[model samples]
Target: MANKIILTGGGSAGHVTVNIALLPELTKRGWNMVYIGSEDGIERELMTPYTNVPYYAIKTGKLRRYFDWKNFKDPFKVITGAYQAYDIIRKEKPQVVFSKGGFVSVPVVIGAWLNRTPIIIHESDVTPGLANRIAIPFATKVCTTFEETSAHVPSQKVEYIGAVIREELLQGSAIKGRNTLFFTRSKPTLLVMGGSLGSKRLNEVIRDSLPLLLQEFHIIHICGKGQVDETLTHQAYRQFEYVTDELPDFLATADLIISRAGSNAIFEFLTLQKPMILIPLPTSSSRGDQIVNAASFQKNGYAEVIPDEQVTKDRLVQTVHQVYEQRSIYMGNMQKVKKRDPLLAIIQLIEKTALSDRSRNKKEK
Candidate 1:
């Protein structure tokens, strides 16, 4: 019988992309893959293109740090989700469950543990998010993109595999990207992105700085959904609510990037050797994971960082010029870092864990 695996994660693009990256390879190896996620989530939309992979939706409540009225009611929803997940796992009888950290993953992990199924979860940030932290004890192995994360989680379960970049991203064509955007080769191209939901502050600052920036470079701004300013249009400026298929091309064409300090995104930029200016989400709005991610990248000479609170029109323009000027230095530092095949590493671990589970089951029988 073929090895079967249940994949779970959602709530944001970051939680889903790693699992997306794993799909092609797992499919090629003849693994039967199923996905369990929230009923309505970005994961559902992103996974729609994969007809072969069966998708199961379950109820999930947002795992929030701050207190809210919903806090009282969410535990019941989570309990329902856990029961639903347990039923699915019982029926599917997968050898292992692989999770990318998100709110939906908690119940799935709990279910997997209840079924005595081995579980593996990936953590992309410097520290485990609330979802991952809750699921860690149940996981057979916890893969991390940052080595420093070991101190925060169970050291025995931690596997520092580094970033698992999507294969397609490395195949992007700069020429194709430039042609699609009608961008010329004479000027540098600056790509700005503020994560999946988009950053209001980033959108406002970038729009405000466009006039000065457009003089030096062609700009592609992924301003997030419903964040576009329809009133302002420029010959050298292009705005997108989001880009799915065209993202690789855009990355290829970019000479420099100004983006939020999400770990997965920054690692992709680093892999592509794109110099960056990072604006981490402020601690007030977040648990400050992005701030730590940005600081790590800056320390490694891979990027520059501006605190979210300090981002201004003038500051953004100045940083753009500074990063563009020092682009080679940043690229050089990125090149100096040794590369590892994290995708393969994670796959090997999954296969190993699955085989062990199968062996133990057989021995007991």
Candidate 2:
């Protein structure tokens, strides 16, 4: 039988991208992968393009840090998800479980733990998210993008694998990107993106500052799904709901970028040597993880962090100019970062986990 593995994580593109990065390596080693995620999440939409990967959806509930009526009801959903996951685990009997730390993965991790499967989780933030924090004890190994993140988790369980960047992203073409979008100018390309869901704040500021921005750069704004404003039809500005296959070229064409401080996104930018201005999610809405991520980038001169209070039309315009002016300094710093091939290391860890299972099985026989 092929070495089988269960990969679980969803709710956002970040959770799915890490798994996508590992899929090629896993397939090369002849591992059959099953994905367990929420029934109607972005994961399903994202994974739909993969014909070989069988997907299974189960019940899932969020674990909120704050009070809500759903708090009581969600636990039952979690229990239901756990039971569903347990059944899937029993049937799949995967050699190991690798979770990417979303709400849906909690039950899958629990189910895998119940089945005596080794669990590995990769966390992309400097601090563990709520789901990963809850899933930690069950995990045999915890992979992190930042070394500082390991300080919060069990030291023995941690390994710093850096970020898992998709190989396709490394192959983006500036010329192809510009030509595809009909960018005919000598001006720089400014790429603006919020997270996968899109950021209302970032969108508003970018749209507000566009009159000043478009004068200097050929702008490509991935203004989130449904967040596109049809009223702004400037020839120099292009807005996309999102790009799947064309993102690499689009990224390659970018001279400067504006984005949220998601670990995977920023790391990809750093790897590409793009000077960026990161507007992290406000702490009131999150655990302040993005702030920590943006701060680290600033500390290392990889990117500039724009404070929430400073996120306005004027400020956005000023910051964009500043980043454009100081682009070389930021690029120089990003170039200094020692890049690691997380896909290889993660695949090795995943394969190692499966190999041990075979050893134990043989010994038992």
* Clash count list over all predictions: 0, 0
- Give, for candidate 1, the lowest lDDT window spanning 10 residues: 149-158
User: In terms of lDDT, which candidate is strongest?
Assistant: 1
Name the weakest run of 10 consecutive residues (lDDT summed) in model 2.
333-342
- Please report how far candidate 2 places residue 70 from its true position, in Å: 0.7
Q: In the order shown, what is each candidate's alpha-carbon RMSD?
A: 0.6, 1.0
Models 1 onward score TM values of 0.99, 0.98
Runs of candidate 1 exceeding 4 Å displacement: none
Give the distance in Å from residue 325's predicted Cα in candidate 1 to where it truly belongs: 0.4
lDDT of 2 by residue, 1-365 (tens): 89899999999999999998888888888889999999999999999987788999999998898999999999988889999999999999999999998899999999999988899999999999999999999999999999898789998999899999999999999999999999975899999999899888888888878888989999999978999899989878999988899999999999999999999999999889999999999888888989999999999998888987679888888888998999999888887888688888899888888888779878989
Error of 2 at 153 (Å): 1.4
Model 1 TM: 0.99
Error of model 2, residue 49, in angstroms:
0.8
